[model samples]
Target: MDSHGSSNGLREEEIDAVAMAVIAVVVNTMADKESSSCNMLMRLRQRRALLQSVAEAPDCAATCEAVVQLCVALTSGVFPRLTPRWWIKRRTGGTWEDLRLRDDATDEYFRQKLRMSTTMFNHIVAACAAYMEKKVTHYRMPLPVEQLIAFALYRWVSGETYESGTSAFGIGRATGLQAFRDVISALLQAYPDAIKWPMGRRRAQILRAFREKGFPNCFGAIDCTHIYIDKPAGAPSENYYDRKQKFFVQAQVVVDLDLRILDVHVGYPGSVHGVRVLHNSQLFRRAESGELFDATPENLPHYVVTRGYLLGDNGYPVACPWIVSPYGGIDQGADEERFDTRQKVARGCVERAFGRLKCMWRLFLRTHKTNLETLPQQFVVVCTLHNILLDTGMDFDENLL
Candidate 1:
């Protein structure tokens, strides 16, 4: 009799008898079907790599095994036969229910197996664990934290609803909502300086990085993305509209060459025009004070800003300091066209940065679940994490954007 049996309410003698009987049954069964049992065990071992975990400790490791079992139960019906796109369940395409795990069968099997692997969990664990501590409090248990956070970011990027996050991320309704907020909060707090400076030595390095090309000192790519927010239930907010007229929170962001957000203005009450927001922003003031300085090439241009430019889209007012879109019919020459192409290419950095930030960390993108009043602080947090990812050189999925 073992203490474990007693914990299960079985008396010691009774447990001992049942254990011996079970052992005898296993021995007899294994002897009668040795090859079959061995093959079954081998199959189980092969699939063990696909599980998720909280930590590497034995208990946490076991929880990962449990996840594998759950996945198997849910996915086994379609594993070998189903196509990857098909297995997604809610998809309406013909690919539905025929999901192929990979290009080849064995590779697909191994791919599925990795879901249970300690190595795989290690990566998810990296994002879920202490990596975010610089911005969040410490709390580790309940492995669902990994999936919840992963799905929250995915939902934001996909522009799906919060309910989609819950179902896709395997989080309960309440947990799904709370986790979206918690992960975003932790990220913003951990990397308070996620939005880095395009200044000093850093600015010099960026200039040098692009100096070989014809482009001169470029501070950052400036752009405004219309973040659609839930409108105030009560307000006289007709001004938020453009000539086309739409309700959205106009957020202006400036990201350095590395795609790290340098500055953001998000509290414009969902009605302010992009031009108005920038006019009052600190970025405009700093540029006006003749503050942007050159680090080398001792020409010492009268306005250091005269040498540098903020790459902007068609919506912005462009100048020597602000490289706005090409002037109407300004086909000065092929070289000018080449420069225009480069500027447009460079302008994408900000839009792509916003796309990635919203995709990876959902605190932005203005979901209906978010409180209207909390938008400002949430905007700050999302921008901050966007920079942290840049600093870390974390591999973000470009194809997603």
Candidate 2:
């Protein structure tokens, strides 16, 4: 048990010394092949200098290893031919750079896949940067934004946390907490076209989905979801003011039978009731406007083929004549009960959409700390693409589907 050497057995500290010794011997032996004992000692010093040039930046050692290791694991599934160059793909997708990602799995097709796999990842980060540049900086920060937003749907929809999402990025825990929110905002604003509410198209898409599902005139399933924010400064009982029993903002969304989000209504105080949320929603106002339905679109019954109303929760006012539901004050078996059950069943589409939405983005899991000032923007960012991801072509078969 020598302090720096293996005697009885190598202790933890001795193990490092042994590893270094082995490395030293390997280098020396290679040099010794061309000459006798110490002829190439000078060359050995050059090798150490090369190693220093590749040293990890201060405090970034583990993070770099983690990123490289994660890349290795992901690419390995798609790339089996395992050479360093073959295992690496450009995060930018344009030109190949020397990432030095070596692998041992010697399959030719798999190795080709390794190079191919990085192309999509490069696009992911590029998309994030393009969005962020417009939304946050308006094309100011020239640095490449990580693929945080693109992979988000994969995480929440597929079930993962912020920590897991940024495992590929060099971002840390607290940074991730803020970064996720920041990225969503930039994404929504920058790529509104990518996640826009189809002013007229919603009508057609909803009609089609309703017909397929055997429900008519159904535009969408609507619901109120609350996102918690920290209680404001000097607000009395703010902490106790939420439906979920927390200080928060309540927002509503209208998603169609296909779980495609058609409209979003966010940015209300938690003190706002669900009915109030709908009443204030642009979707409800538009529905009540009757300009289109009366003219071109022709007021498709609120919930078309079901020959009733679009679906919603109990907190919504029983505009029972226009919208079908159990009379809030009436018994469960009242004339509206059967209708209410059917509406609830239809409403499940949006609920499941919300679940899948939340499942796809871990940022929704926690109550983000924000004031009323920014509440609407955050909720909008979360909802706008809540429906578009259905088309993002993300695979869920790896899960039970």
Candidate 3:
């Protein structure tokens, strides 16, 4: 009857009949002869259209019963919004000073929430502040770099979702996520300056620490651990599911005696073996080419065959000469048994490193529901921060060297 229904190919006679029927009903309902029935019907339709347009206007302030009905129709799950109503809440994590002075076991509580001492946290904030700084004038929220770093650290250590962290940190979910990503990216950019294997005097210090533990010639302990991740969508997911029946990414690490991460090779899929992970690592490639561990042999104990080597478990090949694994169990002698025992003890450093790493950075302890592309960068940031914590005297007593 109206233009809205005319496009459906109604016969002219049918349209006229429908229009006349609508006009007759309207004429009977009202006593106003001031307008014709057809004109009145058209005016009624126009008013309905106006009500709908008002209801949908994003900036309109005035509303009526019609507007409320229109809202119910729009949000009845028939049409979805980019950001749901529940997501737009006030952002809330308090300031770092507020956390530091929180009256509830302040020192230990801050450490529990961030997995680092206040002093160390300050140092880290300082290290990356230049990269994460954002100006906050009267026009926008005062998003300080320190608060951004704190929010990111809180999320990483507590493994809280964006929604939960925003409520505590006093920010929106979108801001929380963006700050978390920004802080992680800044931390990764600081990696080359912060987390590096020892060389020269530092290498000597690490070697000495290993020698004290009765494993001479050991520069670091190498191993791989699976960091849980969500299965990627589509065909590429098969590459991420491992023998453990979980989706994960392999993290190859080389740690010093003090549980400090010296080198890390992250981003390999779980299906890749530890050995293959090492083979693809820069550390392994350097070792094979004799570019690493090239320090001149110095006077040492007879049991110490070389100046630099990495202690690995049976998962790696001992043929590399730089990386040593236990001998085969079959037909082994007391000497081989003793070597295996000592090697296991020496290799505990890497295992302990993994333990503390997972404990301090809770992000790695559970399955990460994040985009697969972002998981690798997150892993690298955690590793880098772990090393940075070690630099600031953070202790892990699991395997004290």
TM agreement with the true structure for every prediction: 0.54, 0.54, 0.71
Residues 1-401, model 1: lDDT tens digits: 45664344545454345445433533433342223466557644443432222122133234445445545643442112222333234322221112222344533332232212233333444655563333311221242455544554455445557665556544456655667677766556555665655766788777765553445666777778776655456555564445545556667888766777778877675567667788888878877766653444323335443456667766666543445465435546876677677776766778788777775654355534445565666677657655654555556655545
- Which candidate number would show the highest TM-score if scored against the true structure? 3
Q: 82-108, model 3: which lDDT tens digit per residue?
A: 333364554345644467474657767
lDDT of every predicted structure (CA atoms): 0.55, 0.51, 0.71
- Mark the regions of model 2 whose C-alpha exceeds 4 Å error after superposition: 1-124, 131-143, 147-182, 194-202, 211-214, 229-240, 291-309, 320-322, 327-337, 366-375, 397-401
After aligning candidate 1 to the native by TM-score, how far in Å is the CA of 351 from where it should be?
3.8
Over 4 Å off in model 3, which ranges?
1-88, 91-104, 135-139, 298-307, 396-401
TM-score of 1: 0.54
Winner by lDDT between candidate 3 and candidate 1: 3
Rank list by lDDT: 3, 1, 2
Q: State the displacement of the C-alpha of residue 391, model 3, in Å, after optimal TM-score superposition.
A: 2.2
